[model samples]
Target: MTNTFSPLATYDRDAVRHWTYGTASTQVPIPPPTGSPYLSDLSFVSGANGWGPVERDSSNGEQAAGDGQPITIRGTAYTKGLGVHAAADVAFYLGGNCTRLTATVGIDDEVAPYGSVTFALVADGRTLTTTPVLTGDSTAVPLDVDVSGVQDLHLVVQDGGDGNAHDHADWADARLTCAQ
Candidate 1:
Protein backbone atom coordinates (compact mmCIF):
# COMPACT_ATOMS: atom_id res chain seq x y z
CA MET A 1 0.00 0.00 0.00
CA THR A 2 1.29 3.46 -0.94
CA ASN A 3 0.26 6.60 0.96
CA THR A 4 0.14 10.07 -0.57
CA PHE A 5 0.05 13.22 1.57
CA SER A 6 0.02 16.87 0.52
CA PRO A 7 2.78 19.13 1.75
CA LEU A 8 2.43 22.85 2.34
CA ALA A 9 3.91 25.06 -0.39
CA THR A 10 6.37 27.55 1.00
CA TYR A 11 6.19 29.55 -2.22
CA ASP A 12 4.07 29.75 -5.36
CA ARG A 13 5.35 29.36 -8.90
CA ASP A 14 6.22 32.71 -10.57
CA ALA A 15 4.35 34.62 -7.85
CA VAL A 16 7.60 36.50 -7.39
CA ARG A 17 11.16 35.33 -7.23
CA HIS A 18 12.88 36.78 -4.17
CA TRP A 19 15.84 36.11 -1.98
CA THR A 20 15.02 33.93 1.04
CA TYR A 21 15.58 36.12 4.04
CA GLY A 22 15.69 34.55 7.47
CA THR A 23 13.02 36.01 9.64
CA ALA A 24 14.75 37.73 12.53
CA SER A 25 13.26 36.32 15.71
CA THR A 26 10.61 38.79 16.87
CA GLN A 27 11.85 37.90 20.32
CA VAL A 28 14.35 40.72 19.93
CA PRO A 29 16.95 40.75 22.66
CA ILE A 30 17.12 44.10 24.40
CA PRO A 31 20.65 45.55 24.29
CA PRO A 32 22.11 46.47 27.69
CA PRO A 33 22.04 50.06 29.04
CA THR A 34 20.41 50.23 32.46
CA GLY A 35 20.92 51.79 35.90
CA SER A 36 23.68 51.33 38.54
CA PRO A 37 26.41 51.88 35.98
CA TYR A 38 24.82 54.65 34.02
CA LEU A 39 27.90 54.58 31.78
CA SER A 40 28.18 51.04 30.58
CA ASP A 41 30.38 49.83 27.70
CA LEU A 42 28.19 46.83 27.07
CA SER A 43 27.11 48.14 23.70
CA PHE A 44 29.92 50.47 22.77
CA VAL A 45 32.75 52.14 24.66
CA SER A 46 30.75 54.27 27.11
CA GLY A 47 27.00 54.82 27.37
CA ALA A 48 25.45 57.80 29.11
CA ASN A 49 22.13 58.60 30.78
CA GLY A 50 21.78 62.19 29.60
CA TRP A 51 23.51 64.04 26.76
CA GLY A 52 22.25 67.60 27.03
CA PRO A 53 21.11 70.44 29.29
CA VAL A 54 20.04 73.31 27.07
CA GLU A 55 17.87 76.34 27.76
CA ARG A 56 14.16 76.69 26.99
CA ASP A 57 13.09 78.58 23.92
CA SER A 58 9.58 80.02 23.43
CA SER A 59 9.45 76.90 21.34
CA ASN A 60 10.13 73.64 23.15
CA GLY A 61 13.58 72.89 21.74
CA GLU A 62 15.97 69.98 22.21
CA GLN A 63 19.00 68.13 20.71
CA ALA A 64 21.26 65.11 21.20
CA ALA A 65 24.79 65.10 22.63
CA GLY A 66 27.37 62.43 21.78
CA ASP A 67 28.15 58.74 21.24
CA GLY A 68 30.67 56.38 22.92
CA GLN A 69 32.90 53.72 21.36
CA PRO A 70 36.46 52.73 20.57
CA ILE A 71 38.34 54.86 18.06
CA THR A 72 39.83 51.90 16.27
CA ILE A 73 42.29 54.27 14.53
CA ARG A 74 41.45 53.03 11.04
CA GLY A 75 38.16 54.72 10.15
CA THR A 76 36.90 58.27 10.07
CA ALA A 77 33.49 58.76 11.60
CA TYR A 78 31.86 61.47 9.54
CA THR A 79 28.79 63.69 10.17
CA LYS A 80 26.67 65.51 7.63
CA GLY A 81 24.58 68.62 8.14
CA LEU A 82 20.91 67.93 8.73
CA GLY A 83 18.31 70.73 8.97
CA VAL A 84 20.89 73.50 8.81
CA HIS A 85 23.10 72.23 11.65
CA ALA A 86 21.70 69.00 13.03
CA ALA A 87 24.40 66.29 13.01
CA ALA A 88 24.78 62.61 13.93
CA ASP A 89 27.89 60.49 14.63
CA VAL A 90 28.46 56.78 15.05
CA ALA A 91 31.02 54.33 16.37
CA PHE A 92 33.13 52.53 13.78
CA TYR A 93 34.28 49.68 15.98
CA LEU A 94 30.65 48.73 16.50
CA GLY A 95 31.03 46.80 13.23
CA GLY A 96 29.10 46.97 9.96
CA ASN A 97 25.98 45.51 11.58
CA CYS A 98 26.06 48.42 14.00
CA THR A 99 25.15 51.07 11.49
CA ARG A 100 21.70 52.44 12.34
CA LEU A 101 21.37 55.10 15.09
CA THR A 102 18.18 57.01 15.81
CA ALA A 103 17.89 60.27 17.76
CA THR A 104 14.72 62.16 18.67
CA VAL A 105 14.74 65.95 18.81
CA GLY A 106 12.42 68.96 18.45
CA ILE A 107 13.84 72.37 17.57
CA ASP A 108 13.24 75.19 15.16
CA ASP A 109 15.27 74.54 12.03
CA GLU A 110 15.58 78.28 11.54
CA VAL A 111 17.27 79.11 14.82
CA ALA A 112 20.50 81.06 14.57
CA PRO A 113 23.34 78.57 15.11
CA TYR A 114 23.21 78.95 18.88
CA GLY A 115 24.65 75.46 19.37
CA SER A 116 25.01 72.10 17.70
CA VAL A 117 23.00 68.97 18.55
CA THR A 118 25.73 66.35 18.19
CA PHE A 119 24.68 62.82 19.08
CA ALA A 120 27.89 60.93 18.49
CA LEU A 121 29.51 57.54 19.10
CA VAL A 122 32.74 57.76 21.05
CA ALA A 123 35.44 55.69 22.66
CA ASP A 124 36.63 56.99 26.06
CA GLY A 125 35.28 60.48 25.31
CA ARG A 126 36.89 61.30 22.01
CA THR A 127 36.23 61.13 18.26
CA LEU A 128 38.46 58.58 16.57
CA THR A 129 39.10 57.56 13.03
CA THR A 130 36.78 54.57 13.35
CA THR A 131 33.72 56.69 14.05
CA PRO A 132 30.56 56.19 11.97
CA VAL A 133 29.43 58.41 9.11
CA LEU A 134 26.41 60.73 9.51
CA THR A 135 24.27 62.29 6.81
CA GLY A 136 20.87 63.83 5.87
CA ASP A 137 18.99 67.11 6.49
CA SER A 138 16.37 68.06 9.08
CA THR A 139 13.48 66.86 6.90
CA ALA A 140 14.45 63.18 6.55
CA VAL A 141 16.90 63.02 9.46
CA PRO A 142 19.07 60.18 10.81
CA LEU A 143 22.74 59.12 11.25
CA ASP A 144 23.62 55.75 9.82
CA VAL A 145 26.98 54.20 10.83
CA ASP A 146 28.93 51.28 9.45
CA VAL A 147 30.18 49.22 12.40
CA SER A 148 31.09 46.12 10.47
CA GLY A 149 34.60 45.47 11.78
CA VAL A 150 34.09 46.92 15.22
CA GLN A 151 32.84 45.94 18.66
CA ASP A 152 32.14 47.27 22.16
CA LEU A 153 30.48 50.42 20.93
CA HIS A 154 28.56 53.03 22.96
CA LEU A 155 26.46 56.16 22.34
CA VAL A 156 26.49 59.73 23.74
CA VAL A 157 24.90 63.14 23.30
CA GLN A 158 26.32 66.66 23.67
CA ASP A 159 25.30 70.15 22.75
CA GLY A 160 27.96 71.29 20.28
CA GLY A 161 27.56 74.66 22.00
CA ASP A 162 25.99 76.31 25.06
CA GLY A 163 24.04 79.49 26.02
CA ASN A 164 20.67 80.17 24.50
CA ALA A 165 20.77 76.47 23.68
CA HIS A 166 17.71 74.32 23.16
CA ASP A 167 16.45 71.38 25.15
CA HIS A 168 14.68 67.98 24.86
CA ALA A 169 16.33 65.08 22.99
CA ASP A 170 15.54 61.40 23.47
CA TRP A 171 17.59 58.75 21.62
CA ALA A 172 16.51 55.17 21.18
CA ASP A 173 16.06 52.32 18.69
CA ALA A 174 19.83 51.98 18.16
CA ARG A 175 20.30 48.91 15.98
CA LEU A 176 23.75 47.37 15.42
CA THR A 177 24.52 45.33 12.29
CA CYS A 178 27.03 42.50 12.23
CA ALA A 179 29.42 41.82 9.34
CA GLN A 180 29.09 38.41 7.80
Candidate 2:
Protein backbone atom coordinates (compact mmCIF):
# COMPACT_ATOMS: atom_id res chain seq x y z
CA MET A 1 0.00 0.00 0.00
CA THR A 2 1.15 3.57 -0.67
CA ASN A 3 1.27 6.35 1.91
CA THR A 4 -0.63 9.59 1.44
CA PHE A 5 -0.47 12.85 3.43
CA SER A 6 -2.51 16.01 3.68
CA PRO A 7 -0.84 19.29 2.89
CA LEU A 8 0.71 20.73 6.05
CA ALA A 9 1.29 24.42 5.24
CA THR A 10 0.95 27.14 2.61
CA TYR A 11 3.62 29.73 1.85
CA ASP A 12 5.80 31.13 -0.92
CA ARG A 13 8.55 28.64 -1.54
CA ASP A 14 10.90 31.35 -2.84
CA ALA A 15 10.90 33.11 0.53
CA VAL A 16 12.03 30.05 2.47
CA ARG A 17 15.58 29.89 3.83
CA HIS A 18 18.00 26.93 4.11
CA TRP A 19 21.09 25.83 6.05
CA THR A 20 22.85 22.64 7.11
CA TYR A 21 24.77 21.57 10.20
CA GLY A 22 28.49 22.44 10.15
CA THR A 23 28.75 22.94 6.39
CA ALA A 24 26.71 22.08 3.31
CA SER A 25 28.81 19.00 2.63
CA THR A 26 26.27 16.49 1.48
CA GLN A 27 26.44 14.67 -1.87
CA VAL A 28 23.24 16.28 -3.16
CA PRO A 29 23.23 20.06 -3.00
CA ILE A 30 20.52 21.36 -0.68
CA PRO A 31 17.40 21.79 -2.73
CA PRO A 32 16.74 25.38 -3.84
CA PRO A 33 14.13 27.64 -2.25
CA THR A 34 11.53 26.97 -4.93
CA GLY A 35 11.78 23.33 -3.96
CA SER A 36 12.06 23.93 -0.21
CA PRO A 37 9.18 24.96 2.04
CA TYR A 38 10.83 26.21 5.23
CA LEU A 39 13.64 28.19 6.81
CA SER A 40 17.28 27.19 7.17
CA ASP A 41 18.49 23.63 7.71
CA LEU A 42 18.99 24.34 11.42
CA SER A 43 22.26 23.68 13.18
CA PHE A 44 22.79 20.11 14.47
CA VAL A 45 25.05 18.45 16.98
CA SER A 46 25.11 14.99 18.55
CA GLY A 47 25.72 14.78 22.30
CA ALA A 48 29.50 14.35 22.50
CA ASN A 49 29.22 12.02 19.53
CA GLY A 50 29.60 12.42 15.77
CA TRP A 51 27.03 13.48 13.19
CA GLY A 52 26.61 13.11 9.40
CA PRO A 53 24.27 13.91 6.51
CA VAL A 54 21.12 11.83 6.22
CA GLU A 55 21.75 9.21 3.58
CA ARG A 56 19.61 8.48 0.53
CA ASP A 57 17.17 5.66 1.17
CA SER A 58 18.22 2.03 0.80
CA SER A 59 18.59 2.79 -2.91
CA ASN A 60 21.97 4.37 -2.32
CA GLY A 61 23.20 1.91 0.27
CA GLU A 62 22.17 4.48 2.88
CA GLN A 63 25.75 5.65 2.81
CA ALA A 64 26.79 8.59 4.94
CA ALA A 65 27.43 10.83 1.96
CA GLY A 66 24.40 12.41 0.26
CA ASP A 67 21.58 14.51 1.64
CA GLY A 68 18.14 13.09 1.06
CA GLN A 69 15.40 14.99 -0.72
CA PRO A 70 12.32 16.53 0.80
CA ILE A 71 9.45 14.07 1.12
CA THR A 72 6.53 15.81 -0.55
CA ILE A 73 3.05 15.20 0.77
CA ARG A 74 -0.18 16.46 -0.72
CA GLY A 75 1.72 19.26 -2.51
CA THR A 76 3.62 20.41 0.59
CA ALA A 77 7.39 19.95 0.96
CA TYR A 78 9.28 18.79 4.06
CA THR A 79 12.77 18.76 5.45
CA LYS A 80 15.51 16.93 3.64
CA GLY A 81 16.48 13.70 5.37
CA LEU A 82 19.37 13.99 7.88
CA GLY A 83 21.27 11.45 10.02
CA VAL A 84 23.67 11.28 12.95
CA HIS A 85 26.56 8.95 13.75
CA ALA A 86 26.42 5.86 15.96
CA ALA A 87 25.65 6.17 19.69
CA ALA A 88 25.03 9.84 18.93
CA ASP A 89 22.23 12.17 19.96
CA VAL A 90 21.51 15.12 17.67
CA ALA A 91 19.35 18.27 17.72
CA PHE A 92 18.39 20.81 15.07
CA TYR A 93 17.78 24.43 16.03
CA LEU A 94 14.89 25.55 13.86
CA GLY A 95 14.72 29.23 14.69
CA GLY A 96 11.84 31.21 13.25
CA ASN A 97 8.31 32.43 13.84
CA CYS A 98 7.20 28.84 13.65
CA THR A 99 3.49 28.16 13.49
CA ARG A 100 3.56 24.44 12.76
CA LEU A 101 6.15 21.74 12.27
CA THR A 102 5.96 18.18 10.99
CA ALA A 103 8.30 15.36 10.10
CA THR A 104 9.10 11.66 10.41
CA VAL A 105 11.92 10.07 12.35
CA GLY A 106 13.39 6.60 12.01
CA ILE A 107 16.53 4.55 11.54
CA ASP A 108 18.12 4.65 8.08
CA ASP A 109 17.10 1.46 6.24
CA GLU A 110 20.59 0.53 5.03
CA VAL A 111 22.09 -0.05 8.43
CA ALA A 112 22.56 -3.66 9.48
CA PRO A 113 20.62 -4.98 12.49
CA TYR A 114 19.08 -1.47 12.48
CA GLY A 115 19.36 -0.22 16.06
CA SER A 116 16.76 1.93 17.80
CA VAL A 117 16.21 5.66 18.32
CA THR A 118 13.79 8.26 19.72
CA PHE A 119 12.58 11.52 18.16
CA ALA A 120 11.60 14.52 20.28
CA LEU A 121 10.31 18.01 19.51
CA VAL A 122 11.14 20.59 22.14
CA ALA A 123 10.49 24.29 22.56
CA ASP A 124 11.71 26.40 25.48
CA GLY A 125 12.36 23.35 27.65
CA ARG A 126 8.82 22.15 27.17
CA THR A 127 8.47 18.69 25.65
CA LEU A 128 6.15 18.80 22.70
CA THR A 129 6.30 15.24 21.28
CA THR A 130 8.55 12.27 21.89
CA THR A 131 8.16 9.19 19.75
CA PRO A 132 8.14 5.75 21.33
CA VAL A 133 10.90 4.05 19.31
CA LEU A 134 11.90 3.58 15.66
CA THR A 135 13.92 0.93 13.90
CA GLY A 136 14.75 -0.13 10.35
CA ASP A 137 11.67 -2.34 10.17
CA SER A 138 9.48 0.36 11.69
CA THR A 139 7.74 2.96 9.60
CA ALA A 140 8.96 6.50 10.10
CA VAL A 141 7.39 8.01 13.23
CA PRO A 142 5.34 11.09 12.46
CA LEU A 143 5.81 14.36 14.39
CA ASP A 144 3.15 17.06 14.04
CA VAL A 145 3.65 19.87 16.55
CA ASP A 146 1.76 23.08 17.24
CA VAL A 147 4.50 25.66 17.54
CA SER A 148 2.49 28.78 16.90
CA GLY A 149 4.30 31.90 18.13
CA VAL A 150 7.31 29.85 19.12
CA GLN A 151 10.59 31.62 18.37
CA ASP A 152 12.86 28.67 18.86
CA LEU A 153 12.19 25.07 17.92
CA HIS A 154 14.42 22.11 18.54
CA LEU A 155 14.28 18.74 16.77
CA VAL A 156 16.20 16.06 18.60
CA VAL A 157 16.91 12.37 17.96
CA GLN A 158 18.83 10.08 20.24
CA ASP A 159 19.80 6.48 20.78
CA GLY A 160 17.06 4.26 22.18
CA GLY A 161 18.87 2.70 25.15
CA ASP A 162 20.49 0.28 22.73
CA GLY A 163 23.90 2.00 22.73
CA ASN A 164 23.45 3.18 19.13
CA ALA A 165 24.86 0.01 17.65
CA HIS A 166 23.37 0.90 14.25
CA ASP A 167 21.80 4.14 15.31
CA HIS A 168 21.72 5.99 12.02
CA ALA A 169 18.71 8.02 13.08
CA ASP A 170 17.03 10.12 10.39
CA TRP A 171 14.89 13.23 10.59
CA ALA A 172 12.92 12.37 7.51
CA ASP A 173 10.72 14.91 5.74
CA ALA A 174 11.21 17.30 8.65
CA ARG A 175 9.69 20.76 8.19
CA LEU A 176 8.72 24.01 9.94
CA THR A 177 6.07 26.50 8.76
CA CYS A 178 6.19 30.11 9.86
CA ALA A 179 3.63 32.92 10.10
CA GLN A 180 3.31 35.28 7.15
Winning candidate number (lDDT): 2
Question: How many clashes in each candidate?
Answer: 39, 3
lDDT of 2 by residue, 12-122 (tens): 557885433332223422222222243325434223233444333311123345543334222333446445544443444434455677766676655634677777777
lDDT, residue 170, candidate 1: 24
- The true-versus-predicted C-alpha distance at residue 3 of model 2, in Å, is 44
TM-score of each: 0.33, 0.57
Spell out the clash pairs found in candidate 2.
19-41, 54-83, 79-174
| lDDT, candidate 1, 1-180, per-residue tens | 123444434555589754433432333333433321211123222222232322111112334433222211112221211111223232223322343333323233334222334455554344432212222223213445543333445444445555224322223223333333
| Residue runs of model 2 more than 4 Å from their true location after superposition | 1-79, 86-96
In candidate 1 the C-alpha lDDT for residue 38 amounts to 14
